[model samples]
Target: MMCFRQVTLSLILLLLGQATPSRLQSLGATKLRLVGPGSRPEEGRLEVLHNGQWGTVCDDNFALQEATVACRQLGFESALTWAHSAKYGQGEGPIWLDNVRCVGTESSLDQCSSNGWGISDCSHSEDIGVVCHPQRQRGYVSERVSNALGPQGRRLEEVRLKPILASAKRRNPVTEGAVEVKYEGQWRQVCDQGWTMNNSRVVCGMLGFPSQQPINSHYYRKVWNLKMKDPKSRLNSLTKKNSFWVHRVTCLGTEPHMASCQVQVSPARGKLRPACPGGMHAVVSCVPGPRFRPQKAKPPRRKDSWAQQEPKVRLRSGAQVGEGRIEVLMHHQWGTVCDHRWDLISASVVCRQLGFGSAREALFGAQLGQGLGPIHLSEVRCRGYERTLSDCRALEGSQNGCQHENDAAVRCNVPSMGFQNQVRLAGGRRPEEGVVEVQVEVNGIRRWGAVCSDHWGLTEAMVACRQLGLGFASHAIKDTWYWQGTPGAGEVVLSGVRCSGTELALQQCQRHGPVHCSHGAGRFSAGVSCTDSAPDLVMNAQLVQETAYLEDRPLSQLYCAHEENCLSKSADLMDWPYGYRRLLRFSSQIYNLGRADFRPKTGRHSWIWHQCHMHYHSIEVFTHYDLLTVNGSKVAEGHKASFCLEDTNCPTGLQRRYACANFGEQGVTVGCWDTYRHDIDCQWVDITDVGPGDYIFQVVVNPKFEVAESDFSNNMMQCRCKYDGHRVWLHNCHTGDSYRANAELSLEQEQRLRNNLI
Candidate 1:
């Protein structure tokens, strides 16, 4: 049916004269599509589709505001600049529209009042071009971020709160801190020049805090014996200088970030003084909502029990929750914990204190990343029963000479969603593969039951799969009559479970109200076929570091690449050697680290044939490669259109089975690697105008989350890089699994990885 649908759609498109090789090709057939040249998706010549033919927009009265609307239509944040005089070469065919006017905020160009359609006095040489800014521009952050570095690496509108002596640290993030703003890549103090709780609310929301509560700074100082610096004090006794960056911030208490709030910003340095004539910097304190606060242990049968404060601990530099360098609060300020004598017991204590179950792994020697500030405790010992790390013993001189490199780390055992025995798979071949079932607790008695077969689909099955830690959802079984009378089976508990499939837990699924089963478990129970073959795709760090290089390829030889839109905007000019594109090239080896093979979702009969690559595209997009700034904004990205999957190498116990060439099965067998050579087509992010600086090389596999896997946590790989125009240095390349193990592994373990790689 799918094949027939695809063929019929192709015929319809051909009849309409709207065939395209790109995804969503027929979408908005009479609308706009950005064409011509560009290294990334955000930059291109403006083209419009009128009637049946695609045409170009004339550069008549076109401005940056119009470019902004066009870029937004192409799904970009905003426009950086627009080109005139056919900078990306002239377009052929009819001039769709001329005298186009836009107010910059229009949803689409057509909505912005143009000179009708197909009306223009100019030729193709008047075609307009545009370059867009990447979505989510924070500022240029770097690896060498320090308090003494001044205002160089800070973002213009980034705001943060720092704590003095008595305050919440990284572990207890929501409790309290002094507000600070980042300007020109440096952290600076915000002057208390008309600051209010409305501004505090906005800052707290940005920090993941829910609400604002009035805090008595004097009471806190007295309780913790905190001695704050006097407002009139000088940085040094020699000179009296006030540290301030933002002044007179005005917020209505509803903005998400400080950037959204109205504020008078200042570049206060040298002779330029701060705006606060009252000699005070803005300060703020927040009370964490119930969700951010750890659960308290209530005394049994005690009417006069007092509530105890939750332990203070936090993870730093973690991409996701429950992992990172562990920090503990001592006295008032938060500091890193020493890795000396660090074990799972001490890690478990830290995890439990932060409202997590147990420690999955105790990472030593700063596995997440190096942290700033002091190393407070060392040689910490815990028996796994302590409620907090404060109950553990520490070395006498723990903080004497510890460095950030020795900072302790941990990966907490966060349950897949909140399904802690609430749901299970019954009557399956393996533990990870099974039919779905739900457990309900009523009157202190637990009852095991099955889900009703009515309206049960793959979307609901996804939540079940994730809850079971069995990877992505593969198939949803509507009926379970074939597997009836099996072990762990029970009466039907839930009926008509409707899920959007994005939910983390099964209980979160919307139901058809109080589920009433019309039949027994064996007759109407909904079954699921979960796969244990969840593939863990990890990038080869060694290949990226050793094989990375820059190349200047001619437009002629890159014809196949151009079809995939791999070249920059200048390529459209038909200029030969002078138009050669400079590309940062690197080989990427993707390894299947799971117990089962990684297979393509589409069947061979329906595979897309790419004329450029002369191969059947088994998968639309297998992975995403991006060059991002330190603050997680993408600078350049690889347009990997399609992939021909195959096993280039395999582990000792695995065998080669899949290949890209010919009509063979396409997949990466367990313990095997799929190598895309350094010079492979579309394996580079065009860095035309990117300045030399620190960057993060991030690659995410199955970004669409289409395929099933055993685990999705290890699908992303990241590396810190420093590019200096002529050279690129890739460092700290690792996956989440390696992060759980430790940043630096033993020689024996490294050898084992090499042996397992194909």
Candidate 2:
């Protein structure tokens, strides 16, 4: 409890001092501080002190990494967002840092690679600011409550959901309620003035349900109007003793407790602060996943099948636990939400529905990068209390004017974890290109040293770059002798730094401690060149939709498909070479619309060769196809197993570089697409034994995370499938990305597409 100041812990980490890094000793006295508005504590325009005068840092290329370093230097835990174009107003001093770059792990900004101090092409209009928080120190904990308020103090103490109309027995824990807060020993109903579902979400989270259920706001206002005006009414009687608790309540939806929110306390009972204004008491309902539905306790019955239905919404392609593009399940397919009017309230509704506290930031312009798929929700209007995004008011169709660049993303406040990585990149041409360095304890003292490069691979370098907050590793360098670093860093500290490529940090990678290095010189230290973008693969939905047809193939002719397990379980049970299976065949063209090429994870030497297929399978388990009931239970699977990647076609000016010929490298280049003919062996979903019914057909490319990509939200394509006894009707086939915003769908075309798998 005595560790009251978070800055004290930050100082401890700094004192553990690795080898003298960069020119920190010369500019070591350089200071950093946040200055500007007094209202927002620990948040303001970022200025650095150099040559004894404070000056603003240029926003030329300022990003999350720079903001992170600034926040950590100022003693805050982490950064929420970085502001450019002088968000807090321009300063009146020399610009100190220009084109400044940081990996965010550095104790001092001087360690970062930059264009140079005072050497800037920017002016005052390019100044940057940042917003940081103080309560997210992952490892440290305060035994006593931290009520020590700095410039900003706690907002509220006791807040509870006050159940209305519900019986007292079921209301003890209070799952559904009109919001109330306790102030100075008096409990009062919170005013609905400027009330949003986000406020309801905060109240629901406090009551143990992070996912706030949808409440009929109109019905509640009607009920309050009907009862509150009566002199003898119970609600009207309570007003004699207490008035509205707060004039206005503001929450970002990321707050763990209501006290963390900005609450405008009610003034003494007066006409100045009107009673609830045009609004009534704020009511909220909540449900805890599938386990605790806020309803009256009832005996179990077979009719409770609603509890087993698939969730209509999901988060995808998020690097962390609770952040990603919001996708809604619509008409048997997953699609993205358009960023039209996408803001905190809508983002908060999504976060709450996903069981996260609140949205820390509602990112726009595809900050997480564009995803592939249909943009389902456009101009989504959420008051924050919706059970899901689907419950909010939104445009009906996917044919919105929005593009993938306008895809919306939400960063939710996730629980802070305790794991820390001492890995960082140093001695490179730029911040994103560097030799890897790690702080390891040697003889009870933690010191910086290079990782031994003996047998070091790209997987190890990837963990290093990611630990530094850089993007995917583009190239893993086995030798770092050309790069310069601290003299002590020449000694290799970590040897055999092998990783399975799934680790987020070098600390989680497998390593040896006895210091075994085949190459004595740390020159062979592990290093990496990082890039912000990677290839993403999405299939041509129109081709799949129009080319689909069914065929009955005898078991004898499917020897290759059977070898790959492309047939269904029913095929395995059937008599060998005697029975026939119904196959749903379609032409699939996978295009690479990303910045990089989609290469096979394995090289030519490691590719698995099957006897039935003449070519090598570069990637194992590349794609998946499934036929599911409307409820999402799979009835049949596809012949999709592995992939032999190669550019089958290219843009007019581009040439194919990768081919799957005899012993060749394989990949699908950017701006190119590889197509598989409908008649290709095993390129269909097996539906021989499936009964005639409505079903959902889905396919996912690179179903496993064996390779890194800039975005994976668009890797899956789905379609609505209907079957009568003799034919299969495929419709609404779409990839879940905004690439089709320009393509208008004709109802007749989709409605007329009918065939059987051949």
Q: Which one wins on TM-score?
A: 2
Cα lDDT for residue 175, model 1? Answer: 43
Compared with the true structure, all predictions reach lDDT values of: 0.61, 0.66
Q: What overall lDDT, based on C-alpha atoms, would model 2 receive against the true structure?
A: 0.66
TM-score of 2: 0.42
What would the per-residue lDDT of candidate 2 be over residues 9-118, giving only the tens digit for each residue? Answer: 11111222211110011123466656554334356777775654457889888898888877666545678989899887777668988998888897667778788888
Segments of candidate 1 deviating more than 4 angstroms: 1-462, 466-472, 475-504, 509-528, 568-578, 736-758
What's the CA error at residue 511 for candidate 2, in Å? Answer: 6.0
- Native-referenced Cα lDDT, model 1: 0.61
